[model samples]
Structures are given as structure tokens and as C-alpha cells.
Target: MQETGVKLSREIVTALVEDATAAPSMHNAQPWKFLFRPSDSVFQVYADLDRAMPHADPTTRALHLGCAAALFNLRVAAAHAGWEPVTRLLPDPADPRLLAEVALAGATAPENDLAPLYPAIHRRHTSRQPFTDEEIPRAVKDALSGAALIEGARLVFPDAWHVQTVLDLVGDAEGRDATEPAAAEELRNWTRVGAGAADAARDGVPDYAFGPRGRHGSAPVRDFAGQQSVPGRGTAVFEGTPQLAVLGTPGDRPKDWLRAGQAMERVLLQATLDGLATSLTSQALERPELRWTVRDPQSAMGFAQMVLRLGYGPSGPGTPRRPVDEVLDIE
Candidate 1:
């Protein structure tokens, strides 16, 4: 694994790509492709436009977020595998879909700070189940915030009133989705229900990962089973006072979204390592007006990129991911 002259081994390259694909995406679309240039030990990330949800994510902000998350994972994986990843976001402005290019340089030391988060990479899941009402410790919260800062973003735990407001906005988005045929169609297109689809398909949110219907709670979890009724899906009461955190960046461009996405995965991995279950709700941020309102004027966080729900609950089952071979191209 020499950084200057030698190409990365096939096994190591495969492992890095596998860890990258494990990142969470909107509806588990896994809208990312990786190209490994063995000649220069460079790994490129590209967005798969075919998998983009045009109706729900018109500007492709969510797509960039997903790809950036994978980019963060690649960095972590490289560190854990004894390489220092030098990443360049949007390396080519002409190709908007080319999100990032990571050049792996062999590290003198095998262990790095990101090595500790390597284990949590596989452990982190989007838990939709209800979390207990217990509050997160201040120290743990601070650590999560630090993780976001390292990735060039801010993570803020809003006050109760702000949390309530964001929850209300989420509810409004959900209500709009119920009547918005385009939104419903977009969700259905990315969600897999039957056993065949859930087990066989490599991407999309499966029926099992949808969690139970929100019988009573204000957790702001997205209900993937919009109108279609599943046979065994039961209703459950979620946490009333969910510990919500907003991740934001100073700007609202493609580069900002990419940084926010990296910050997001860093925070999530850190939280997972700290024994907290987490889920995301970008519903409010999906709408233009609502996205603006989600930002706290009193805080330094400029534009809210994501709303995170954190608490004590099940870690969630693993969702399906595309195989490394399908997503990676080696030259």
C-alpha cells in the first residue's frame, strides 16, 4: 500500500468501497458510484442520476448529501486501513455529478483518530423505533458537536420551543406529502415492500426497516408506508421528548451540502459509538420556506441541513446495500 508509487491491493480497494457503500442515503437509494484509479491510487465518487428522486429532491441536495456521507466513510476507512485520504470535493465543476476525489496516501502510523470510529461504521443505522425519554449526557452531546466541527459544520441541540417548532414543520411536510401525488410517487418508487423486493433488491428502504406506525409520539420519524397497509406492521408509541439536533453549514451550495453530509456521518458514527440510537428527518428542510424557518436566527448555524432524532432505543436492523462490484470501477 505504498502511497507514492504503488497501486492499492485489490482486497484493500474492495474493502474500502464496501465500507463506503454502507453509508445511509435518502430512502436507501444508494445513489453513488465509485471509480478506483489504481494508477494514481485515487478513488472518485459519482452520483447515479438514475437513482435520484427528482420529485422529492429536485435540486439534488439530498443526492450530494448521500454521496458526501459515503465520502466521509471512505476517509474513515482509509484511516483505519493505514492510509490518509486526501479528498477534493467537486474536483471538476464541469461535471456536477462528480462529487469527490479521494487520494489515498499511506500513513506512517497504522492507527489514526478515525480508526476508533471504524467499528461504529457498521453499527450505525437509522433507527425508526421509539426511543426512551432519557436525556443524553452533556459530555456525549459535546462530543457529537465536536465531531461535526471537525468536518466543517455545526451541530446544535435546539431548545424545547425550537424543537417543537421543527416537529410541527415536519408534521406539516408529512401532511403535504399525503396529498402530494408526486411526493407519494417518489417515495413509492424508492421503497420496497414485498419479500421478494426486500430480500432481493440491493437498494431502497425495505418494509422491515420502516418501523411501526407512529401511534402516539412526536419523534418526527418519516412514515415510509404512506398509504399502503402492510400486513404485520404494528403501531407503537414513540418518545414524546426526542433529543433533536440540527446540523448546519454556513452556506447553502453544493459544496456546503457535501461538507454537511460529511459532518452528518461523523456525528452519527460518534453518536453510535456513544450508545445512542439515531434517525434523520429532512422533511422540513425539503421544502424551501420550511427549510429557512428551521434555522435558528439566534444561533450561528446558518442553514439547517438535517434534523436528527437521538435517544436510547434499538440500533435498528441493517438495510441492504449494493455490492462493491456493482458500484466500483477499477482502472
Candidate 2:
């Protein structure tokens, strides 16, 4: 990590940020910025409020979740680079926009655990495509739950009835998105179809990543196209029994949201390492009125932060990300 053991170079900083920005965000809205202070080797993460989804994520809970996931990736990158990441979330009360601050210090002991996940950082993508009905192994499921728990969050694999509940909620939310002008407009604004997707520089959900519409069964893939005609988009039958997991924390504060973000990414990365395709949907949790009901009454989890679709199938196409220069600055 320290080529000269004296100062950190700009190239290294940019690379770290590049890995950081690979995190998933609602609508592919990479809503985070990084400031690298070379003097102290500290990177400051801030939420780019402009990239926030106002209609779908009105409270910016999803925005915070995205930023925090980016922050978690930074930690993994730093560890893989042989620098210990010392992170502080919501570092400034005066400036609520400051989501996290990470100091990259030399590690005396190697980060064996985090370094392994660095590879999955690149391999893991949201798989909007249909997955097989094959059940995930018990050991793999346990590992994923452990990953979330390690980051101060809980992952609950709901029963059959609860899975149906989640599917129903997604249907309800999607219907609302159609009827509500604000949500429909926001969805259009965030999606790229036809030429828009092919020439997309960065950000937003490209049509290719939209996956096939679920012709049959209970897959919760969001139709990013809404009603627009994507010339080459195809439709396919999805899994009848889609395996879903709910990631949540006891509290719903900004800090808690940040922790849940880290937990969610860790689970995704671990799942990737274990050879499982994945996707995410929060339509049910996005609507405030329907959020609480998404959580199972029997579960100890409080606020549902994310709903993950996991299985063994084709991983979704990679979405575009803003260039490091566009989102990162050296001070």
C-alpha cells in the first residue's frame, strides 16, 4: 500500500474512491462524494443531495443507505490496500451532509477477512434477472446472516407467508408508482431507455439492467421501463418461490441507516463469494405508509431498511457510475 512509506499518491486515492463508488443506490443514483485530504490520509464522504430520489426516497433514508454502502466499500478497499480504515459516521452535527470520515492508517496486522471481500466488491451486481427455484443451502444462508450481524444489523429470512407479504407490498408500491404522478415522473427521470442507455455516461438504471418483466411467479424485479417501449427488452418467467431476506436495524436514525448500509453490502459481498446471484427491492419499504407492515410481527427487527432478492442465476448487468474526478476531490 505504501510504495515509498512516506506519502500517499493521488493515483492510490482515486483508485480507493473508484472502488468506493461501486456501491448500489436506489435507481442507480450514485449519490455520494468523497474528499481526500492527502496531508492526513483522511477521506471525507458526503451525500450529494442533488442525486437523491425525492419521490421514491422522500426522507433520503435510501440515500443515506447508499452513501454508507459506499463508505463500507472504502473500508474494504483501504483494508485490501493494507491501510486500516478508521471510520466515523455522521461526523459533523453542524453539517448533516457529512455522512462519514475515514482515516487510512497503516495496518500492523493484515486484514485477512476484509481483503477477501475486495474481489466480491467488483463481482457483485444486482441480478434483476429471474433465478432458479433451487433453495439456498443452510450454511450459505447462515453465513449471510452472520455478515449482516457483524455490522450491527439483523437479516431475517422470512417464512412462506411473509414472502407472499413482501410480494404483495411490491405489487402495491408498483401500482402506486403508476398512479402517483410524482413517483412516475421520478422513475422516468432515473431510468435510461433505448439510446439513453447505450450512451449513458454514468448513473441511472439503464434499460439493459432492467431485467425481463416477471411474466409468471413472484419475482420482485422492478420494471424500470414503466410503460416505455424498450425496442429489444425481453420478458421471461421468474421463480415461483423467490428467496427474500429483510435487512434491518433496531433504530432508524441516520447512523443506524449508515450501519445497515454497511451490513447490506457485507451480506451482498459474502453472498457473492458464496456463489449466489442477488438483487434488491425496497418498494414496500419506500412508501412510509406500507413500511412498517413489511417487517414480520414475529421478527425482532424493527425498521426494514432493505429487501434483498437472492438466488443462483444470471447476475444483472453492471450499471454506470460517475467518474472519480466527477465525485472526488483532493484538498
Clash count for each candidate, listed in order shown: 0, 0
> 177, model 1: CA deviation in Å?
1.0
The clash number for model 2 is 0
lDDT of 2: 0.89
| Alpha-carbon shift of residue 211 in model 1 (angstroms) | 0.5
lDDT for model 1: 0.90
TM-score of 2: 0.96
Tens digit per residue, CA lDDT, model 2, 17-112: 999999999988999999988777888999999998878888999999999999999999988888778788887899999999988767725534
lDDT of 1 by residue, 125-221 (tens): 9999999999999999999999999999999999999999999999998888889999999999888898888889788899999999999988999
Measured against the true structure, the TM-scores of the candidates, in listed sequence, are 0.97, 0.96
Best by lDDT: 1
At residue 236, give the lDDT of candidate 2. Answer: 92
